[model samples]
Target: MLDFTNASKLKKIEVNYQYDKFSWDHPGSSAQLIRDGKPKDAGMVEAPLNEIDQVIQNAFNQKVMPGAVVSVTRKGITVKEQAYGYAYRYLDDQFTEADQPILMKQDTIFDIASISKIFTTIAAMQLYEKGKFQLDDPVAKYIPEFAENGKENVTIRQLMTHTSGFEQGIELYKMRASREERLKAVLKHSLANPPGSKYTYSDLNMITLGVLVERMTGQRLDEYVKQYITDPLGMKDTMYNPDIYLQPRIAATEYQPWTGRGIVWGQVHDENAWALDGVAGHAGVFSTAHDLTILGQMFLNDGKYGKALILKPSTVKLMEQNMNQAFPGNDHGLGFDLNQGWYMDGLTDVNTIGHTGYTGTSLVISPKNKAIVILLTNRVHPTRNTESINQTRRLVARQAADAIPVAIPGNKNAWFAGYGDQKNAILQAKVNIQKPSVLSFLTWYRMEEGSDIGNVEISLDGTTWNELGFFTGASDQWQEQSYQIPEGTKFIRFRYTTDSTVNERGWYVLQPQIKTDQKNIAPEFTSTDWELRNR
Candidate 1:
């Protein structure tokens, strides 16, 4: 029901904002810099309609579980929806794209494993937007039973951010006798670490939230989710429990060894949630790529889908704000994983939000970029022993990011400078200086293995170098160092050498400048500053 006209106007404005932020060099020209090959023009780089199809064909071609479905959207328009592989490989019935196989159709339902947390999170935020609850409100307020075992102080915000200090996981299916007992066990369990000390992604946080929603609304979590989110957003296929008629369209999950649940198909694969009747806040929602796209767009639209405000714009903003500041790389927002380099490849760092399901599903949304990448694969089928589909997820998301031509044509992908593996061989970058001029060079560096003996050197040429300084190498501590280049230097170079063996991942560079006179400003020095140095 959204007005595409208004959305289009808003998208144009947003694109301009991003273009400025990224300092994109051209309007509508973008390139994907292949390490060893010529940069490909993203606008013309054609592959399969769905980027995941390409990945599936490459990595998961031999796997079972029928097929895979992937979809990507930008500014409310779906750019791709592709299916590959089999919906039921062993079945004698030949499958085609038209058949809508259990795992292959555009609308085929998927047990989105932990992706259900996003729905629960949005539902909770909706209640908050309606003034039904406060983010800081203690869970004990709605579910008094949750206050037991020193958990009276656990706030809703903590649960959403996975900072409640609950244990990573609990096998409710094996430990508890019944659903009621499982619920009781969750409420009675104590914290593994002090609350809010650090992020330990836990299912208990959301399980408790599910209980809170049920207790407050006098409705099951699934019912509340349907009435508030799915129904209003017109996501007809998303639900915690599907009818028998829909089972044939659902993809298979795991072959559990302990729960006696053989080859879980058309049922929630999580053992703990399965014990709780497939309706927990952390997991157990079944949906399709199309249905999930609606939710993705809602977040991209800042919580308004059509006329209904499922969540306040402010609440959605808070969900995208990083809460794991103390823990640097483990970027997390309220109920959303963020700034994940491995999964959110090529997306804006601060503006993108996404989460991955254990069942090989991932959703990456970049509101600022008006982009969404959804890859749904049942890599857990036949077995859950596979290491991780992170590479595939990253590749697909990067492909989507690459597809969006940067407003500027020649801007290079952001640089990721890190220490090389060779302890004795120092990483170096050289900049050529043609004429005598006063130059300012800026360097950003951080040490992975904090060491007091780490030092940097600047060289006029490859033979002789001058020591910049020494600093204790500490993880995640980025220090900016600047210097002035002396006149008459033919070339300048930087070397990060360590007296003691230690690892580091940071950057060194020369800042760009605007020339006052109409003379050609020779390109600056430093490895990252050079256009085509090492390659």
Candidate 2:
């Protein structure tokens, strides 16, 4: 094993980045800690916990890494914290022994892989408050070698935004053994595309960032983070290079024949991070579900956790604000990935932000809904080819979201598009009507882009279906839609359709009204599948 004691011997470089405390830039000091008490009424009744439990149990039955830990929080209340299946069923190449699996528990520690980047980003932002660095500074200014191979213009912001034009990463394991050689190769590597011209997620961006932090402060990445972050947050179980005594409590991940390591556990799983003696930027941090709940709550509380102040409210705002708008759907902030639908699922909304790890871990925080959900699993255990656990991620996120009621009680009844792989759930009402009638309702929806859709149609003679309009976008603020009821219309139908793929956030229609002969009449909206919801 490479000596980790030589961290101080790493080359010292000039720091180019600098931060200024401009009046407009100050998001002000962090907000007060908001402690979670008993579950407060947020209008939501019950979380769809049965669905989530079923998903995890199904994963266990399917042999998807044997076990997992899922935690869900909504409106400052801990909704769910449960463990499933086995933590370790086997240590060999295959899970051969069926009865030897280690039982999973709620408090098992997990290697959070790429999710560690969020911690690094948080640490960097803390230093920024101390006037350590400006975001736009050139990488070459701090590390002179980064100027090589047409990379002099790469800025700190680009690295965080994932527009640094770097490829995924260099296989340092296949290259020479020295850390400096691998780092130099990384800095000097040619760009696959022009900087800021595109967004390509890469490990090199955060790796170089780890290097920059070291260069600026002469502190090891883990040490700096521990002192400024985890310790303050009281995340006792979150750290790098966890003690030998904690190994039994840690989830096992991967059986790596490629690295000649059998049953990789306790240590960092990312090869590049392992090359750096388990202290790299892209991955390395390990955490428990309970500790992550504290972290997520801190973010929701605007960077304050209990008595410890980690970041300013303004800094957290800046981190959640989109910086990769030019890349459209790839919404991102300084360090957090924003609006990712793959794992975030129903949790993704206007202010949704979080990160995912390669070892079947996910974190989603929705500021708009006052929610946070974490799913940690050792999906790579016993083998790396195990199928993805994305469905489980989506299922848990959706369950948490369902806890937040979308019902509007005052309306008595608003059309509720029950969330599922709905093919075409139509709501139709038969009513006595004349020429020049008006069909109106308050409508809001978050339909799946280009896949799921909602359509409004009218049947004049109650035989032929005529398309009135279709809704295919999202809105944080509700919208009002009105359709002119075709003359001599006897029936109206609100058709909400969905694919067998991802489900929509489901539509909400309030105040279904009809106007006939100068009379605005409240008519019963008939439904075959859609249900009336009272918020």
Candidate 3:
């Protein structure tokens, strides 16, 4: 039998490398301005990024969406930009068009749908920075009519965070005929819950925000976004509605007959946004993948892009801070979703933030790693009843995350705790001790907050163990940790538990040592699903 705890007679543990070299730059915090560069120039691995092409091809093969455009940027470099499949493939819900469908191009424009909310948010923040209004100020203060329907107490922050009492939405396309009447219906809509009492996602919040922006700036939402956002950033291809001449480059969307629209193409797919002249706060922005990467890079750069200061850095920080702490699992910043792993996948951390559009669009920004990942598709083309593209979203995000390697210490392999939802992995070792000692190790982790957990435990009897320390969220870099070993301790272990939900990049451990006043001890560990490999 091998001595589980021996100081000098034990063999040295060996490790293996899976890559050329491990990078130590991630989950990093350096923000670089967006520019064009190759994947290797950004310290990203090309093999994993190459896998992204096949994922998109598989989605196209399965008809998950008629087409898709993807963009990935790291360290301010545009590493990957590609397009796949058809931009317009169907004539109606049940039949393909008889004509040669337009092929997807790198510059193809997409109906970004709910991603428009971020634009509205940026426009509102501009006014707020100009001292036009405060976040805590009630919407009624600017748009006085919004005070109707028991919403007098709903503040601008409540609306941005979706904690206001407003209902999800009203049937503007069905209940109203004109834009003015639809606006009235929204202003007078009733509450579904009390203000600040719960977090309920509702388009009424963004709709109200759109009206507020217009009321404050005396310009329509489209004009304000164009002048303050798209124009300043040189996003010529991004807009609320494309002109007739630009229809050739736009993607087709749902075929709607209820609103007297047939084979909806080159226009906003959202019926409510269409009723509102394709400029509502909740939906109706259109842009190509390259244009959105610029917008995302601006946010990652903290409100500045290539000499244009679109928003104050302070305001950007405020927007990045999670405002919906009262509600767990639904973390929301001012207007962006924070650390949502459903779509963010391994890219998710406490500070990783992004949003998804109903039209098969998702954008993830990792400020820590200074990276941006954008995936756009028109799954609603021809119909809205197609299969969900959520799995593809998570897969692409994970691949982008894998492209950024985690630097291993001394360029050696470390023990990796496997990753998956509902995981319960443990690495335990027996210790022989009669007096006090110290246990120390180096570790790095990025786990789903409040769901995945890593714990260090010690036991005297083996049947019962006491937690020495536990960690959640992320350790932006590798850290050295030490704990005093209790007298009579016989075993020590690292137990990582995760709930049945989002799984992130898991825990890594290396150089575990037990020390006494007189000598050093090496441990022989038994692990469940843990392996030694350089990631």
Global CA lDDT computed for model 3: 0.84
Off by over 4 Å in 2: 1-43, 407-411, 449-451, 461-463, 477-480, 499-504, 518-528
Runs in model 1 deviating more than 4 A are 1-53, 61-67, 90-103, 409-435, 438-535
Q: What is candidate 3's CA lDDT for residue 502?
A: 74
Q: Give the winner by lDDT.
A: 3
- Per-candidate TM-scores read 0.73, 0.89, 0.84
- The TM-score, computed over Cα atoms with residue i paired to residue i, of candidate 2 is 0.89
lDDT of 3 by residue, 357-399 (tens): 9989999998877788999998888788877798889889888
Report every candidate's CA lDDT: 0.65, 0.78, 0.84
Model 1 alpha-carbon miss at residue 76, Å = 1.3
Task: Sort the predicted structures by lDDT, highest score first.
Answer: 3, 2, 1
Q: Pick by TM-score: which candidate is best?
A: 2
Encode model 2's per-residue lDDT on 223-277: one tens digit a residue: 9999989998888999999998998888988888787777888898888888888
Clashing pairs in 2: 18-134, 27-314, 407-535, 408-535, 409-535
